[model samples]
Target: MQADIQLLLTADGSHTVRHETLGVTYHSIHGAVQESQRVFIELGLQAAFERFANVPLRVFEMGFGTGLNALLTAREAERHGRPVAYTGVEAYPLPPEESQKLNFDVALGTTFLNALHASPWHETVNISPFFTLNKQQTSLQNWQTNERFHLVYYDAFAPSAQPELWEPEIFQRLACFLLPGGLLTTYCSKSYVQRNLRAAGFTVEKHPGPARKREVLRAISPPIL
Candidate 1:
């Protein structure tokens, strides 16, 4: 696997980027990671959490990458005192030493980096009173879990770089883990991606993308009767 480390700028002039499999971080010119945080974490995850305002919010994340999304979620859960269970799947997990540099406090400011790195990896680990993070270091294609997720952060590499992750079969498998009314959000809003989500039995929507991008994708499953 290739690894890239570089800088990327957000619409608000924030910087973020770290590659695990692809040299040269920061997609194109603008900040890919920053856009991800804005679109997925802030808009997608937080919105889903708000709609389901019960304790113990369960979140599933694809492409753990630099652990930025998890760190952001941890900060929000801790600050808001909302119990959260976060499950992140990554084919190639980033080393703790590398993840420590995420430093959400510097950018988002919530001491999330420390908490995330401090949380030991095992079968499961509780990071704080409000946050429990479980990491699966395997391709999501092979993951199996009956646990239903209220929200999913689908932040994979671009379609051009990694086409396999965008396949319909993978989406179909992932859709099974989402409970009725669960929502999935990603930065890509291509028509093909939306079609895949729909084929997987989701109600898909095309939304304005973050930063320089044109559009994003959000999907929701109907509640089980």
Candidate 2:
């Protein structure tokens, strides 16, 4: 483990990494697995699947910390026999040595996770027939892409960890990356966060959060003016 990182066992027996320097964990300490399954997969991916059945869905994730969200999404795509093209942007990717210590593969009973971690950054890898992943190692502020997505998993650390990410300019860029009516879900439901999304032209809603959290936000993109 890196000197600045510590692995913590969450309430659900899952491992989460705490960045001692950044003062944040990769996932909620309540239960890393449950948080991903609820916020990203169930709320974001599953809901999008309902409206985009039989279509190859495009998903963009802001932070690909442990690859947990991507792994769960791949399973969901296979379970429903749908296809998903996932793009995850991480300014600072977790080291392979540390990510290897995570037990999500065994916990989820999946083998492709190893492949996800091995796949080189900045290239799209076909991890499964139903799932394609593109991991970009660049900050959202500096990253550029013309592709749009149907759903976005805003899994970045809390505003306290990286306040710049929660600003209005970032939300405006995210809004432009989505097709009209597309969904963006995150574990954050802070009032100012909602205001930023609204300022960026999203119709925001608060939904019941998973353990240790009260609410989450799911925002819909409106046509760009």
At residue 205, what lDDT does model 2 achieve? 93
Q: Candidate 1: which stretches are off by over 4 Å?
A: 2-15, 18-29, 32-34
The candidate that wins on TM-score is 2
Locate the minimum summed-lDDT window of 10 residues in model 2. 1-10
Q: Per-candidate TM vs. native? A: 0.86, 0.97
Tens digit of lDDT per residue, candidate 1, span 70-116? 87787778778888899888776656555665544676656656666
For residue 199, give model 2's deviation from the true position in Å. 0.4
Candidate 2 residues lying further than 4 Å off, grouped into runs, are: 1-3, 223-225
Query: Root-mean-square deviation of each candidate, in angstroms?
Result: 2.7, 1.4
Candidate 2 Cα deviation (angstroms), residue 177: 0.6
